[model samples]
Target chain A: MIEQDWIWGLVGGLMIGSAAALYLLVNGRIMGASGIIGGLVDRSGWEGGTERAAFLAGLVLVPMLVVPLYETVETHITSNLAVVIVAGLLVGVGTRLANGCTSGHGVCGISRLSLRGIVATVFYLLGGALVMALARHVLGVI
Target chain B: MLRLLSALVAGGLFGAGLLVSGMVDTTKVQGWLDVFGDWNPTLAFVLGGAIVPMAIAWRVAERRKVAVLGGPLPLMTEGEARPGRNLIIGSTVFGAGWALAGLCPGPALASLTFGGTGGIVFVVAMAAGMLAAPPIRARLDRMQPA
Candidate 1:
């Protein structure tokens, strides 16, 4: 049985909020993680230098900051690097193909009540659930 | 300055929510899916907890006639149903992949805050997907009507 910690939820919310703030404050972009991470690959899309670097850096560095505070953090991921690399690549391609990443369509777009965003998000959730089922249950890949 | 501050507020709140919900962990997600094995209910609680904020936010935003995030407030637009054949096929493909990855963009970033090799890989691949999609879209768009 998996345990749910309310603290983690709160932390997640703040990170998402701070990231969103940083993105908009300096770059005028939404903190849609997909877009930010995606921008790393397509840097030309972003105009500002200090802001983009800082924003992207925050994504990478903020977690490192947590290490000192939390000391050691552990996670459950059984997939090898090769699997992750391929998955990440597929998601990058998917976001561009679908016209928005999960954060853009799922968080901001759906929150905005955009029809396109809603449709995209529904598909995303369903996709996520299906993926989990297939990987863990069907394939027995931990 | 005000715009930036407000943006910060919104994002901070969003990050906090991810932590509180335990969504930062794919194991939690996998637990939810492996109902026969572990039968995790945290996902249900998250779905439930989300309702509270959603209601409050909806009501407040409706009353204010403004989005707390600032910008032109968005209203729902119900367009004439034009569900294309491609939409169905595309959704099928997307759902399949998401089920496999468990690390969608939002959590992947938050997971990065925790700093792990898998999380890093999850994010890197997600970025690649985002980059490759556009050209594919352009190609398809060229074949279809605007």
Candidate 2:
């Protein structure tokens, strides 16, 4: 599965890029997934609530439309409830604190060569690799 | 209405892209991060692929004052251009969570319909964490004085 999927990754990535491009070109917003959700969840971005809601609706609902096109949609998430909960909290707090996530910092920020975006991406990747090493290799959990 | 529709289409495309790219797969994401074990480089392709069109879009946006649909384009504010303590700390924390679960915000949401109960739980917890962030941020700021 891993060996044959890079092509799909590339293709899907292009689609994502196109989506960001369209969002910027038409709606004039950076297609940052977490920021969009953050705004609604915290009411900080309520001014554009309708637009954000519409985007999220498409994000959650439209994927169902394409699920039938594939054979499997495996997520392989950890069965350990503790890990899931902790990870979720970290992701939530971390993204909010940083003010962006992969879409915001990694994709959109880096594309525009924003220093904050590039710096955030580097730190997060380092943090992820370090934790993966610690948990999977040293701690033997994950 | 057009703004709403455009947002919907962009989001739909983003979701579809995530599905097709296998970003929804936790093993694949973990595999990409698993340097000590079997490593998968597919995520690099995805990231690179995503940047291509977005880079072009930025260039196009440079010439335009507003979106083609008549909304203001994103202008990087002074604060956003500068990297700070929160940016590094928060990103690192976020990355740890992402690596642990093999899920990030985009894939987490995209996989909700089919990601089973675990997916739902993660989303809920993540939302809780988000709700908890402002207080944490304020506290952290007070501690560091930055």
Encode model 1's per-residue lDDT on B43-139: one tens digit a residue.
5555444433433343344455444445433233324234343343344444455545556665577567564677777776676666666676667
Model 2: per-residue Cα lDDT over A1-108, one tens digit each? 666799999999999999999999999999999899999999999998999998888889888778867787678888898999999999999999999999999999
Q: How far in Å is the alpha carbon of B141 misplaced in model 2?
A: 1.1
Candidate 1 lDDT over residue span A44-90, tens digit each: 45654344345445444444455456533444654577767766666
**Candidate 2 segments whose C-alpha is farther than 4 A from its true place:** A1-3, B75-79
Residues B25-46, model 2: lDDT tens digits: 9999998888888889999999
> Chain A TM-score of each model, in the order shown?
0.77, 0.96
Clashes of each: 48, 0
- Which of the CAPRI classes, incorrect, acceptable, medium or high, describes model 1? acceptable
